[model samples]
Target: MKNNVKLARIKANLTQQQLADGVGITRQTISLIEKGKYNPSLKLCLQICYRVNAQLDEIFWISEEEFNSEENN
Candidate 1:
């Protein structure tokens, strides 16, 4: 899935490590999430949203095609 985690992080003036620290996750995990290499659990996702002061959809919303494909899995 695609996300705007990096964008929100930048808009919040947070480095990846800083955001990770705020959310209690590893910096690598935040990097992976931004790169779309990992999908965070809902709890973790909510943490990120809260840290970045972003609405869930603003950061973690996926494209319709991606969402549809996931439904097929």
Candidate 2:
């Protein structure tokens, strides 16, 4: 999956460490999330959404491929 976490984080003037600390995760985890190498749980997602002041759809956008795959299931 892809996300705009990095962009939003940057726009929010938050470093990876800052966001991770606020969200109670590791900086590496935040980095991984930005890189799209890790999938955050719903709890973590909510934390990020609130901290960044961004909507779920804005940051963790659902790709067309993922949406179609979900429909298939």
Instruction: State each candidate's clash count.
Output: 0, 0
Clashes of 1: 0
Give one digit per residue, the lDDT tens place, for model 2 in 1-73. 5789999999899999999999999999999999878899988998998999999889997879886785676
| Model 2 ranges off by over 4 Å | 66-73
Candidate 2: RMSD over Cα atoms?
3.2
TM-score of 1: 0.87
**Model 1 RMSD, rounded to 1 decimal:** 2.2
lDDT score for candidate 2 against the true structure: 0.89
TM-score winner among the candidates?
A: 1
Q: Provide the overall lDDT of each model, using Cα atoms, as 2-decimal numbers.
A: 0.91, 0.89
Task: Estimate the Cα RMSD of every predicted model relative to the unseen true structure.
Answer: 2.2, 3.2
- Candidate with the greatest lDDT versus the true structure: 1
TM-scores across all candidates?
A: 0.87, 0.85
What pairs collide in candidate 2? none
